[model samples]
Target: MQALLQEAASRLHAIEDRLTVRTQIAAAVAAMSIALVSTLAAGAAIISYRHTAALIESSVAGIASSTSARLDRFMATRRQEMKLFTELEPMQRLWQGDPTELRSALEALQRNFDFTWIGFADLNGNVVASTGGLLQGKSVAARPWFKQGLENVVVGDVHEALLLASLLTQRANNEPYRFVDIALPVRDTSGKVIGVLGGHLDWTWASNLIADVQANDGNTDTRLSILSKGGMVLVGPKRETIRYGGDELADMLKVRDGTFRETVDGQQMLTAFHVGNGYRDYQGLNWIVTAS
Candidate 1:
């Protein structure tokens, strides 16, 4: 009995230590599980954010592309129509010395196509026949369209109409007349270049197209802009002159279609851009379309 008691006492040291070790191991396992779950949650959140941003960027890019395509098609169709109209025998009869018939044809064209003005200019830049006869006998020698038309088919960018502004019907709010020029050299029966057919499209047509795009896009948060090759804002929601700097333009030209975060007029925004690629047989003006 004495030997047994001594053996039992030797083996009976601190049984609670095993319990403590077990508790520590259990706590460590719980901590590891929690930490793993936390890491996974953080990673998921990051991925979700990136995905959402990508989708938003893609949406805006689509808008910009669609708008650019529509504008290109419209311009292409008009230019193609003009190219065909010029080859018609009725138009070729203009040089037959009947100014009234020529003027009548110009008026019919303006009426059909919603042009602000249409005129025929001789090689010497004399306005021989016009839509309303307003610029008749006037010399358009200094006009860019007339000069460019002498060489090749031309479609000019938007600009304030200098000589035709006051002569045109004024808006109630007194906005100046703006125009986009379409001009091409006319050829005689023997394929000799005779004169130029110059037409001024109402800039309102472009503005209306923009309005329609905005309305159809169904995104109130999206802002759209039409920018010239020079980066000047040709049409936009705001009246301020918004122009992209050289650095921005260079980056945009590199991609031609993409999105970037930017600050415009003190507001932070994400902007998507698409460059214009003109339709068949028409050279694009390199206009940039933007949606933010």
Candidate 2:
């Protein structure tokens, strides 16, 4: 009876040991399964994040491309209009030393094109005829546009309309008016450079152009600007910081045409640029058109 009892006790002990080993094995398998699942989840999350980032970048690039192209077309149209103005019969008559024809021609042009002012200057830089007759006898020899227009067609940088302000006795508001001058050399029938035909375009017209782009795209967040090659802001949003050419815009002067990522005014931006390529026979001003 004692031997039988010992055998029963030994069998019970062996069964318990086997049960403990099986439990340990099951626990190890479960731990490994959990670890594997966690690693897979992490990898999937990383992949999803990268995919989302790529999609966002692609969308931004598309918008930049479309906006840049639209702006380029707009600039091209303006250049064409200026070219056509240089070829007008009245303008040609002015080049033939008929200063009397200038007022009527300029008035017609202003009525048709909505220019702020259309002025013609003789070779001596004396204003012979003007739309408003304000600066008819004024000499523009000291102006940058006059010097530039002597050799080729030129588009002057934006500046305060000091002449216009001084000429007008009445005031619509205290706000200062700004204007951009576009000038082309007038040639006689013998191809002699005789005079210059120029016009002052209101700054508001440029602002409206940008506004139209934004309205068409329904994207108010995007920024559009026309910049000088020297990094000066020719036309931009109402924001004083951007309009004045902040430090962030410094690098843009070095880039002729391309896309880059930048931080502007504490906001991350993707910017694309298009350098002016002269349209047809017109030589472009080499300005930079930026979309961000």
User: Which pairs clash in model 2?
Assistant: none
Supply candidate 1's per-residue lDDT for 31. Answer: 100
Q: Write the per-residue lDDT of candidate 2 for residues 91-200, one digit (tens) a residue.
A: 66565556667687778878877468888888999998888786899998878877788887777666888767777554467757777777878787678988887877
Candidate 1 overall Cα lDDT vs. reference?
0.86
**TM-score of each model, in listed order:** 0.87, 0.73
Go through the candidates in order and give each one's C-alpha lDDT. Answer: 0.86, 0.71
Candidate 1, residue 189: how far the Cα is off, in Å = 1.8
Give the local distance difference test score of model 2.
0.71
Q: Candidate 1 on 1-292: residue-level lDDT in tens?
A: 9999987776664456777889999999999999999999999999999999888888899999999998888888878767777899867777657989999988988788867898999999999989889899999989999999988889999899998987888899888888889999899899988889898888888779888888887665778899887788888856336578678888776678888888988989999999999989887888899999
